[model samples]
Target: MSTVLTHVTDELQSIFDRARSVAVLTGAGISAESGVPTFRGGGDSEIWTWRGRPVTELSSAELIATDPQLVWEWFDYRRGMLTSVEPNAGHRALAEWERRFEDFTLVTQNIDDLHRAAGSLNVLELHGNIWRARCLRCASTFEARESPLEENPPRCLACNGPARPDVVLFGELLPDGVFERAEEAAARADLFFVIGTSAVVYPAAGLPITAKRRGARIIEVNPEMTDISFIADVTLLGKAGELLPQFLKERG
Candidate 1:
Protein backbone atom coordinates (compact mmCIF):
# COMPACT_ATOMS: atom_id res chain seq x y z
CA MET A 1 0.00 0.00 0.00
CA SER A 2 1.05 3.60 -0.57
CA THR A 3 2.13 5.81 2.32
CA VAL A 4 -1.18 7.73 2.23
CA LEU A 5 -3.21 4.55 2.38
CA THR A 6 -1.07 3.34 5.26
CA HIS A 7 -1.71 6.55 7.16
CA VAL A 8 -5.46 6.40 6.44
CA THR A 9 -5.65 2.76 7.49
CA ASP A 10 -3.95 3.56 10.78
CA GLU A 11 -6.19 6.58 11.39
CA LEU A 12 -9.36 4.67 10.56
CA GLN A 13 -8.39 1.86 12.88
CA SER A 14 -7.79 4.32 15.67
CA ILE A 15 -11.24 5.89 15.18
CA PHE A 16 -13.04 2.54 15.01
CA ASP A 17 -11.29 1.37 18.16
CA ARG A 18 -12.32 4.44 20.12
CA ALA A 19 -15.68 5.52 18.73
CA ARG A 20 -18.83 4.31 20.48
CA SER A 21 -21.23 6.24 18.25
CA VAL A 22 -20.65 6.78 14.53
CA ALA A 23 -22.45 8.64 11.77
CA VAL A 24 -21.87 8.06 8.04
CA LEU A 25 -22.99 10.33 5.20
CA THR A 26 -23.08 9.12 1.60
CA GLY A 27 -23.97 10.67 -1.74
CA ALA A 28 -24.33 9.96 -5.50
CA GLY A 29 -20.68 8.95 -5.76
CA ILE A 30 -21.34 5.75 -3.80
CA SER A 31 -24.33 4.82 -5.96
CA ALA A 32 -22.57 5.79 -9.20
CA GLU A 33 -20.19 2.87 -8.83
CA SER A 34 -23.24 0.60 -8.63
CA GLY A 35 -24.41 1.81 -12.11
CA VAL A 36 -26.56 4.64 -10.81
CA PRO A 37 -26.00 7.95 -12.65
CA THR A 38 -24.84 10.97 -10.68
CA PHE A 39 -26.41 14.43 -11.01
CA ARG A 40 -23.28 16.38 -12.03
CA GLY A 41 -20.13 15.85 -14.14
CA GLY A 42 -19.78 14.76 -17.78
CA GLY A 43 -21.20 11.22 -17.71
CA ASP A 44 -23.98 12.30 -15.37
CA SER A 45 -25.11 15.21 -17.54
CA GLU A 46 -24.93 13.14 -20.71
CA ILE A 47 -27.49 10.66 -19.41
CA TRP A 48 -29.82 13.19 -17.79
CA THR A 49 -29.16 16.20 -20.04
CA TRP A 50 -31.87 15.46 -22.59
CA ARG A 51 -34.34 17.07 -20.23
CA GLY A 52 -32.43 20.37 -20.68
CA ARG A 53 -32.73 21.13 -16.98
CA PRO A 54 -30.80 20.73 -13.79
CA VAL A 55 -31.90 18.03 -11.34
CA THR A 56 -33.33 20.75 -9.15
CA GLU A 57 -35.42 21.99 -12.05
CA LEU A 58 -36.86 18.57 -12.79
CA SER A 59 -37.78 18.09 -9.13
CA SER A 60 -39.12 21.55 -8.40
CA ALA A 61 -42.49 21.93 -6.68
CA GLU A 62 -43.69 24.17 -9.50
CA LEU A 63 -42.95 21.47 -12.05
CA ILE A 64 -44.69 18.80 -9.97
CA ALA A 65 -47.82 20.88 -9.49
CA THR A 66 -48.07 22.61 -12.89
CA ASP A 67 -46.99 19.71 -15.08
CA PRO A 68 -47.53 16.52 -13.17
CA GLN A 69 -47.35 14.28 -16.23
CA LEU A 70 -43.91 15.59 -17.15
CA VAL A 71 -42.72 14.96 -13.62
CA TRP A 72 -44.13 11.42 -13.70
CA GLU A 73 -42.37 10.71 -16.98
CA TRP A 74 -39.09 11.78 -15.42
CA PHE A 75 -39.76 9.68 -12.36
CA ASP A 76 -40.71 6.70 -14.49
CA TYR A 77 -37.38 6.91 -16.28
CA ARG A 78 -35.49 7.16 -12.97
CA ARG A 79 -37.45 4.25 -11.49
CA GLY A 80 -36.52 2.06 -14.42
CA MET A 81 -32.88 3.05 -14.07
CA LEU A 82 -32.85 2.25 -10.36
CA THR A 83 -34.51 -1.13 -10.88
CA SER A 84 -31.73 -2.30 -13.17
CA VAL A 85 -28.87 -1.37 -10.82
CA GLU A 86 -27.63 -3.26 -7.75
CA PRO A 87 -25.70 -2.37 -4.61
CA ASN A 88 -21.90 -2.34 -4.90
CA ALA A 89 -19.15 -3.39 -2.50
CA GLY A 90 -19.01 0.00 -0.83
CA HIS A 91 -22.69 -0.34 0.08
CA ARG A 92 -22.13 -3.82 1.47
CA ALA A 93 -19.19 -2.60 3.56
CA LEU A 94 -21.33 0.09 5.15
CA ALA A 95 -24.09 -2.43 5.85
CA GLU A 96 -21.59 -4.75 7.47
CA TRP A 97 -20.34 -1.91 9.65
CA GLU A 98 -23.91 -1.23 10.75
CA ARG A 99 -24.22 -4.83 11.97
CA ARG A 100 -20.93 -4.60 13.86
CA PHE A 101 -21.43 -1.24 15.53
CA GLU A 102 -23.71 -0.92 18.53
CA ASP A 103 -24.62 2.65 17.54
CA PHE A 104 -24.37 3.76 13.91
CA THR A 105 -26.38 5.86 11.50
CA LEU A 106 -26.11 5.65 7.70
CA VAL A 107 -27.22 8.87 6.10
CA THR A 108 -27.59 8.79 2.31
CA GLN A 109 -28.55 11.44 -0.21
CA ASN A 110 -29.21 9.09 -3.11
CA ILE A 111 -32.81 8.15 -3.77
CA ASP A 112 -31.81 4.68 -5.02
CA ASP A 113 -32.63 1.85 -2.60
CA LEU A 114 -29.20 0.21 -2.90
CA HIS A 115 -28.26 0.96 0.74
CA ARG A 116 -31.34 -0.87 2.01
CA ALA A 117 -30.85 -3.60 -0.59
CA ALA A 118 -27.34 -4.10 0.75
CA GLY A 119 -28.93 -4.85 4.19
CA SER A 120 -28.22 -1.56 5.96
CA LEU A 121 -30.58 -0.62 8.79
CA ASN A 122 -30.80 2.72 10.65
CA VAL A 123 -30.44 4.55 7.33
CA LEU A 124 -31.60 8.13 7.04
CA GLU A 125 -32.29 9.07 3.43
CA LEU A 126 -31.77 12.82 3.39
CA HIS A 127 -33.35 13.20 -0.05
CA GLY A 128 -35.92 10.35 -0.14
CA ASN A 129 -36.55 6.91 -1.64
CA ILE A 130 -37.75 6.29 -5.18
CA TRP A 131 -39.85 3.28 -4.19
CA ARG A 132 -42.20 5.34 -2.04
CA ALA A 133 -45.07 7.61 -3.07
CA ARG A 134 -47.46 9.95 -1.29
CA CYS A 135 -50.78 11.51 -2.15
CA LEU A 136 -50.60 15.18 -3.06
CA ARG A 137 -54.05 15.85 -1.62
CA CYS A 138 -54.16 13.86 1.59
CA ALA A 139 -50.40 13.12 1.99
CA SER A 140 -51.15 9.40 2.48
CA THR A 141 -47.97 7.43 1.84
CA PHE A 142 -47.45 3.97 0.31
CA GLU A 143 -44.60 1.83 -0.88
CA ALA A 144 -44.75 0.98 -4.57
CA ARG A 145 -43.29 -2.49 -4.87
CA GLU A 146 -44.21 -2.77 -8.54
CA SER A 147 -45.50 0.66 -9.46
CA PRO A 148 -48.91 0.29 -7.78
CA LEU A 149 -50.69 2.93 -9.86
CA GLU A 150 -51.15 2.62 -13.60
CA GLU A 151 -52.05 6.23 -14.26
CA ASN A 152 -49.17 8.33 -15.57
CA PRO A 153 -49.05 10.42 -12.41
CA PRO A 154 -50.71 7.78 -10.20
CA ARG A 155 -53.47 8.38 -7.66
CA CYS A 156 -54.01 7.55 -4.05
CA LEU A 157 -56.38 4.67 -3.35
CA ALA A 158 -57.66 6.36 -0.22
CA CYS A 159 -58.49 9.85 -1.56
CA ASN A 160 -58.29 9.09 -5.28
CA GLY A 161 -56.05 12.12 -5.63
CA PRO A 162 -52.77 12.81 -7.39
CA ALA A 163 -49.73 11.12 -5.88
CA ARG A 164 -46.10 12.11 -6.26
CA PRO A 165 -42.86 10.45 -5.35
CA ASP A 166 -42.23 10.79 -1.62
CA VAL A 167 -38.88 12.42 -2.34
CA VAL A 168 -37.99 15.99 -1.35
CA LEU A 169 -38.57 17.91 -4.55
CA PHE A 170 -36.92 21.30 -5.10
CA GLY A 171 -38.66 24.10 -3.20
CA GLU A 172 -40.42 21.50 -1.07
CA LEU A 173 -39.45 21.11 2.56
CA LEU A 174 -37.83 17.87 3.68
CA PRO A 175 -39.98 15.50 5.68
CA ASP A 176 -40.08 17.11 9.14
CA GLY A 177 -39.33 14.01 11.21
CA VAL A 178 -36.50 12.77 9.01
CA PHE A 179 -34.45 15.99 9.19
CA GLU A 180 -34.79 16.09 12.97
CA ARG A 181 -33.56 12.53 13.29
CA ALA A 182 -30.60 13.16 10.97
CA GLU A 183 -29.63 16.26 12.95
CA GLU A 184 -29.83 14.36 16.21
CA ALA A 185 -27.63 11.59 14.85
CA ALA A 186 -25.07 14.09 13.58
CA ALA A 187 -25.00 15.94 16.86
CA ARG A 188 -24.45 12.76 18.86
CA ALA A 189 -21.83 11.14 16.63
CA ASP A 190 -18.40 10.53 18.08
CA LEU A 191 -16.89 9.75 14.70
CA PHE A 192 -18.36 11.09 11.45
CA PHE A 193 -17.49 9.57 8.08
CA VAL A 194 -18.35 11.59 4.98
CA ILE A 195 -18.33 9.33 1.94
CA GLY A 196 -18.86 10.06 -1.74
CA THR A 197 -20.36 13.52 -1.15
CA SER A 198 -18.93 16.96 -2.02
CA ALA A 199 -20.70 18.54 0.94
CA VAL A 200 -22.18 21.26 -1.30
CA VAL A 201 -25.91 20.87 -0.83
CA TYR A 202 -27.37 23.07 1.86
CA PRO A 203 -28.65 21.98 5.27
CA ALA A 204 -27.45 18.48 4.48
CA ALA A 205 -23.95 19.86 3.78
CA GLY A 206 -23.95 21.41 7.21
CA LEU A 207 -24.21 18.00 8.90
CA PRO A 208 -20.49 17.20 8.90
CA ILE A 209 -19.75 20.69 10.23
CA THR A 210 -22.40 20.19 12.88
CA ALA A 211 -20.77 16.96 14.04
CA LYS A 212 -17.36 18.63 13.90
CA ARG A 213 -18.53 21.48 16.12
CA ARG A 214 -19.80 18.91 18.63
CA GLY A 215 -16.24 17.45 18.86
CA ALA A 216 -16.80 14.55 16.43
CA ARG A 217 -13.82 13.51 14.39
CA ILE A 218 -14.62 13.94 10.67
CA ILE A 219 -13.12 11.54 8.13
CA GLU A 220 -13.69 12.18 4.43
CA VAL A 221 -13.43 9.36 1.87
CA ASN A 222 -13.55 10.46 -1.73
CA PRO A 223 -11.44 10.39 -4.90
CA GLU A 224 -11.62 14.16 -5.20
CA MET A 225 -11.31 16.95 -2.68
CA THR A 226 -14.60 18.28 -1.30
CA ASP A 227 -15.60 21.49 0.44
CA ILE A 228 -15.19 19.82 3.83
CA SER A 229 -11.79 18.30 3.07
CA PHE A 230 -9.87 21.04 4.83
CA ILE A 231 -11.82 20.52 8.03
CA ALA A 232 -11.67 16.71 7.94
CA ASP A 233 -9.44 15.03 10.48
CA VAL A 234 -8.22 12.65 7.76
CA THR A 235 -8.79 12.71 4.01
CA LEU A 236 -8.65 9.25 2.44
CA LEU A 237 -8.27 9.81 -1.27
CA GLY A 238 -9.74 6.76 -3.08
CA LYS A 239 -13.00 5.27 -4.26
CA ALA A 240 -15.23 4.38 -1.34
CA GLY A 241 -15.46 0.75 -2.48
CA GLU A 242 -11.72 0.44 -2.16
CA LEU A 243 -11.16 2.55 0.97
CA LEU A 244 -14.15 1.48 3.09
CA PRO A 245 -13.38 -2.25 2.89
CA GLN A 246 -9.76 -1.57 3.81
CA PHE A 247 -10.85 0.47 6.81
CA LEU A 248 -13.31 -2.21 7.86
CA LYS A 249 -10.72 -4.94 7.50
CA GLU A 250 -8.41 -3.02 9.81
CA ARG A 251 -11.24 -2.68 12.31
CA GLY A 252 -11.75 -6.43 12.25
Candidate 2:
Protein backbone atom coordinates (compact mmCIF):
# COMPACT_ATOMS: atom_id res chain seq x y z
CA MET A 1 0.00 0.00 0.00
CA SER A 2 1.05 3.61 -0.54
CA THR A 3 1.80 5.98 2.32
CA VAL A 4 -1.57 7.69 1.91
CA LEU A 5 -3.46 4.41 2.12
CA THR A 6 -1.45 3.30 5.14
CA HIS A 7 -2.15 6.54 6.98
CA VAL A 8 -5.93 6.47 6.24
CA THR A 9 -6.18 2.79 7.09
CA ASP A 10 -4.56 3.36 10.48
CA GLU A 11 -6.81 6.33 11.19
CA LEU A 12 -10.01 4.43 10.30
CA GLN A 13 -8.87 1.36 12.17
CA SER A 14 -8.33 3.37 15.33
CA ILE A 15 -11.86 4.72 15.12
CA PHE A 16 -13.57 1.44 14.29
CA ASP A 17 -11.72 -0.32 17.06
CA ARG A 18 -13.09 2.09 19.62
CA ALA A 19 -16.49 2.99 18.21
CA ARG A 20 -19.58 1.55 19.84
CA SER A 21 -22.00 3.06 17.33
CA VAL A 22 -21.41 3.58 13.61
CA ALA A 23 -23.57 5.01 10.84
CA VAL A 24 -23.16 5.06 7.05
CA LEU A 25 -24.89 7.28 4.51
CA THR A 26 -24.94 6.06 0.91
CA GLY A 27 -26.18 7.56 -2.38
CA ALA A 28 -26.51 6.96 -6.13
CA GLY A 29 -22.70 6.73 -6.50
CA ILE A 30 -22.63 3.52 -4.45
CA SER A 31 -25.38 1.95 -6.49
CA ALA A 32 -23.74 3.15 -9.69
CA GLU A 33 -20.64 1.13 -8.80
CA SER A 34 -22.79 -1.98 -9.18
CA GLY A 35 -23.96 -1.20 -12.74
CA VAL A 36 -26.69 1.22 -11.65
CA PRO A 37 -26.61 4.32 -13.83
CA THR A 38 -26.53 7.84 -12.47
CA PHE A 39 -29.60 10.06 -12.72
CA ARG A 40 -29.63 11.68 -16.18
CA GLY A 41 -26.75 9.31 -16.98
CA GLY A 42 -28.76 6.74 -18.96
CA GLY A 43 -31.77 5.12 -17.31
CA ASP A 44 -33.35 8.41 -16.29
CA SER A 45 -32.90 9.93 -19.75
CA GLU A 46 -34.59 6.95 -21.35
CA ILE A 47 -37.59 7.43 -19.10
CA TRP A 48 -37.86 11.02 -20.27
CA THR A 49 -37.13 10.29 -23.94
CA TRP A 50 -39.80 7.62 -23.91
CA ARG A 51 -42.37 10.41 -24.11
CA GLY A 52 -40.20 13.20 -25.58
CA ARG A 53 -40.40 15.05 -22.21
CA PRO A 54 -38.57 15.22 -18.91
CA VAL A 55 -39.52 12.94 -16.04
CA THR A 56 -39.29 15.88 -13.62
CA GLU A 57 -42.20 17.49 -15.48
CA LEU A 58 -44.42 14.49 -14.80
CA SER A 59 -43.06 13.14 -11.53
CA SER A 60 -45.63 14.57 -9.19
CA ALA A 61 -48.83 13.56 -7.41
CA GLU A 62 -50.86 15.63 -9.82
CA LEU A 63 -49.33 13.83 -12.80
CA ILE A 64 -49.89 10.44 -11.18
CA ALA A 65 -53.51 11.39 -10.56
CA THR A 66 -53.86 12.82 -14.07
CA ASP A 67 -51.99 10.22 -16.14
CA PRO A 68 -51.10 7.24 -14.00
CA GLN A 69 -50.21 4.98 -16.93
CA LEU A 70 -47.48 7.31 -18.18
CA VAL A 71 -45.86 7.46 -14.73
CA TRP A 72 -46.14 3.69 -14.23
CA GLU A 73 -44.58 2.99 -17.63
CA TRP A 74 -41.61 5.20 -16.79
CA PHE A 75 -41.01 3.38 -13.53
CA ASP A 76 -41.64 0.01 -15.15
CA TYR A 77 -39.01 0.75 -17.76
CA ARG A 78 -36.47 1.61 -15.04
CA ARG A 79 -37.36 -1.51 -13.07
CA GLY A 80 -36.82 -3.67 -16.13
CA MET A 81 -33.29 -2.30 -16.42
CA LEU A 82 -32.71 -2.86 -12.71
CA THR A 83 -33.42 -6.60 -13.00
CA SER A 84 -30.22 -7.07 -15.00
CA VAL A 85 -27.75 -5.71 -12.43
CA GLU A 86 -26.42 -7.13 -9.17
CA PRO A 87 -24.73 -5.72 -6.09
CA ASN A 88 -20.96 -5.16 -6.30
CA ALA A 89 -18.22 -5.70 -3.72
CA GLY A 90 -18.80 -2.40 -1.89
CA HIS A 91 -22.31 -3.58 -1.03
CA ARG A 92 -21.02 -6.89 0.23
CA ALA A 93 -18.39 -5.12 2.39
CA LEU A 94 -21.07 -3.01 4.02
CA ALA A 95 -23.19 -6.10 4.60
CA GLU A 96 -20.22 -7.71 6.34
CA TRP A 97 -19.56 -4.54 8.38
CA GLU A 98 -23.19 -4.61 9.56
CA ARG A 99 -22.41 -7.87 11.32
CA ARG A 100 -19.25 -6.43 12.88
CA PHE A 101 -21.05 -3.63 14.66
CA GLU A 102 -24.03 -4.06 16.94
CA ASP A 103 -25.18 -0.47 16.38
CA PHE A 104 -24.34 -0.08 12.71
CA THR A 105 -26.93 1.67 10.55
CA LEU A 106 -26.90 2.00 6.75
CA VAL A 107 -28.90 4.94 5.45
CA THR A 108 -29.27 5.17 1.67
CA GLN A 109 -30.89 7.61 -0.73
CA ASN A 110 -31.04 5.03 -3.52
CA ILE A 111 -34.46 3.72 -4.42
CA ASP A 112 -32.89 0.52 -5.80
CA ASP A 113 -33.14 -2.58 -3.62
CA LEU A 114 -29.46 -3.45 -4.23
CA HIS A 115 -28.45 -3.12 -0.59
CA ARG A 116 -31.10 -5.56 0.49
CA ALA A 117 -30.14 -7.80 -2.41
CA ALA A 118 -26.57 -7.72 -0.99
CA GLY A 119 -27.90 -8.97 2.38
CA SER A 120 -27.99 -5.75 4.36
CA LEU A 121 -30.80 -6.23 6.89
CA ASN A 122 -30.76 -2.96 8.85
CA VAL A 123 -30.92 -0.55 5.91
CA LEU A 124 -32.90 2.66 6.37
CA GLU A 125 -34.12 3.39 2.85
CA LEU A 126 -34.60 7.16 2.71
CA HIS A 127 -36.20 6.84 -0.70
CA GLY A 128 -38.71 4.03 -1.02
CA ASN A 129 -37.84 0.99 -3.18
CA ILE A 130 -38.73 0.84 -6.88
CA TRP A 131 -39.54 -2.87 -6.71
CA ARG A 132 -42.54 -2.04 -4.53
CA ALA A 133 -45.61 0.07 -5.29
CA ARG A 134 -48.00 1.86 -2.97
CA CYS A 135 -51.69 2.52 -3.42
CA LEU A 136 -52.53 6.20 -3.73
CA ARG A 137 -55.89 5.75 -2.05
CA CYS A 138 -55.78 2.96 0.53
CA ALA A 139 -52.03 3.49 1.21
CA SER A 140 -51.29 -0.22 1.03
CA THR A 141 -47.99 -1.29 -0.63
CA PHE A 142 -47.28 -4.37 -2.75
CA GLU A 143 -44.30 -5.91 -4.50
CA ALA A 144 -44.13 -6.34 -8.27
CA ARG A 145 -42.16 -9.24 -9.66
CA GLU A 146 -42.06 -7.49 -13.03
CA SER A 147 -43.52 -3.99 -13.23
CA PRO A 148 -46.66 -5.03 -11.29
CA LEU A 149 -48.94 -3.35 -13.85
CA GLU A 150 -47.53 -2.61 -17.31
CA GLU A 151 -49.90 -1.19 -19.94
CA ASN A 152 -52.12 0.50 -17.35
CA PRO A 153 -51.50 1.28 -13.71
CA PRO A 154 -53.04 -1.24 -11.35
CA ARG A 155 -55.70 -0.36 -8.82
CA CYS A 156 -55.45 -1.00 -5.14
CA LEU A 157 -56.78 -4.47 -4.35
CA ALA A 158 -58.77 -3.06 -1.47
CA CYS A 159 -59.93 0.43 -2.55
CA ASN A 160 -59.48 0.18 -6.36
CA GLY A 161 -57.41 3.39 -6.48
CA PRO A 162 -54.26 3.94 -8.53
CA ALA A 163 -51.09 2.19 -7.40
CA ARG A 164 -47.74 3.87 -7.89
CA PRO A 165 -44.10 3.01 -7.27
CA ASP A 166 -43.40 3.44 -3.54
CA VAL A 167 -40.55 5.85 -4.19
CA VAL A 168 -40.37 9.44 -2.96
CA LEU A 169 -41.19 11.19 -6.19
CA PHE A 170 -40.93 14.84 -7.28
CA GLY A 171 -43.43 16.23 -4.80
CA GLU A 172 -43.84 13.46 -2.27
CA LEU A 173 -42.30 13.40 1.21
CA LEU A 174 -40.08 10.51 2.31
CA PRO A 175 -41.74 7.50 3.84
CA ASP A 176 -42.77 7.78 7.51
CA GLY A 177 -40.21 7.03 10.25
CA VAL A 178 -37.18 6.84 7.91
CA PHE A 179 -35.70 10.28 8.51
CA GLU A 180 -36.41 10.13 12.21
CA ARG A 181 -34.42 6.93 12.65
CA ALA A 182 -31.64 8.20 10.38
CA GLU A 183 -31.37 11.46 12.29
CA GLU A 184 -31.29 9.68 15.62
CA ALA A 185 -28.63 7.33 14.31
CA ALA A 186 -26.55 10.27 13.13
CA ALA A 187 -26.92 12.09 16.44
CA ARG A 188 -25.71 9.10 18.42
CA ALA A 189 -23.04 7.77 16.11
CA ASP A 190 -19.55 7.26 17.48
CA LEU A 191 -18.24 7.02 13.92
CA PHE A 192 -19.98 8.30 10.81
CA PHE A 193 -19.17 7.51 7.19
CA VAL A 194 -20.58 9.29 4.20
CA ILE A 195 -20.07 6.81 1.39
CA GLY A 196 -20.42 7.35 -2.36
CA THR A 197 -22.82 10.28 -1.87
CA SER A 198 -22.60 13.67 -3.52
CA ALA A 199 -24.02 15.20 -0.31
CA VAL A 200 -25.86 17.99 -2.12
CA VAL A 201 -29.44 16.84 -1.65
CA TYR A 202 -30.99 18.70 1.23
CA PRO A 203 -32.48 17.26 4.40
CA ALA A 204 -30.51 14.10 3.61
CA ALA A 205 -27.44 16.33 3.19
CA GLY A 206 -27.99 17.60 6.69
CA LEU A 207 -27.25 14.18 8.24
CA PRO A 208 -23.43 14.25 8.11
CA ILE A 209 -23.55 17.72 9.60
CA THR A 210 -25.73 16.41 12.38
CA ALA A 211 -23.13 13.71 13.09
CA LYS A 212 -20.31 16.27 13.04
CA ARG A 213 -22.21 18.47 15.50
CA ARG A 214 -22.77 15.52 17.81
CA GLY A 215 -19.00 14.70 17.94
CA ALA A 216 -18.93 11.63 15.66
CA ARG A 217 -15.67 11.30 13.72
CA ILE A 218 -16.45 11.61 10.02
CA ILE A 219 -14.86 9.55 7.24
CA GLU A 220 -15.91 10.03 3.64
CA VAL A 221 -15.40 7.13 1.21
CA ASN A 222 -16.04 8.44 -2.26
CA PRO A 223 -13.95 8.31 -5.42
CA GLU A 224 -14.42 12.04 -5.77
CA MET A 225 -14.79 14.99 -3.46
CA THR A 226 -18.29 16.13 -2.46
CA ASP A 227 -19.75 19.17 -0.75
CA ILE A 228 -19.21 17.48 2.62
CA SER A 229 -15.61 16.41 1.98
CA PHE A 230 -14.28 19.55 3.63
CA ILE A 231 -15.91 18.47 6.86
CA ALA A 232 -14.68 14.87 6.93
CA ASP A 233 -11.96 14.00 9.41
CA VAL A 234 -10.63 11.54 6.85
CA THR A 235 -11.54 11.32 3.17
CA LEU A 236 -10.35 8.11 1.54
CA LEU A 237 -10.76 8.90 -2.13
CA GLY A 238 -11.59 5.91 -4.40
CA LYS A 239 -14.41 3.64 -5.48
CA ALA A 240 -16.22 2.21 -2.43
CA GLY A 241 -15.77 -1.31 -3.83
CA GLU A 242 -12.02 -0.91 -4.30
CA LEU A 243 -11.30 1.21 -1.25
CA LEU A 244 -13.63 -0.24 1.39
CA PRO A 245 -12.39 -3.82 1.36
CA GLN A 246 -8.79 -2.65 1.38
CA PHE A 247 -9.53 -0.14 4.14
CA LEU A 248 -11.00 -2.94 6.24
CA LYS A 249 -8.37 -5.56 5.43
CA GLU A 250 -5.19 -3.46 5.70
CA ARG A 251 -6.06 -1.06 8.50
CA GLY A 252 -3.92 -1.83 11.51
- Backbone atom clashes (below 3 Å) for every candidate: 0, 0
- Where does model 2 exceed 4 Å of error? 1-8, 40-50, 148-151, 250-252
The CA-based lDDT of model 1 is what?
Answer: 0.81
Q: What lDDT would candidate 2 get against the real structure?
A: 0.80
* Candidate 1 TM-score, true structure as reference: 0.91
- Angstrom error at residue 114, model 1: 0.9
For model 1, residues 7-121, the per-residue Cα lDDT tens digits are: 3556568767678899999988888888788766524433644377776678789989898888877888788777778888899999998987788999988888899999997
lDDT of 2 by residue, 153-239 (tens): 776667878788788887778889999999999999989989888778878999999999999988888776667877888777878
Q: TM per model?
A: 0.91, 0.89
Collision pairs in model 1 = none
Q: Which candidate has the highest lDDT of all?
A: 1
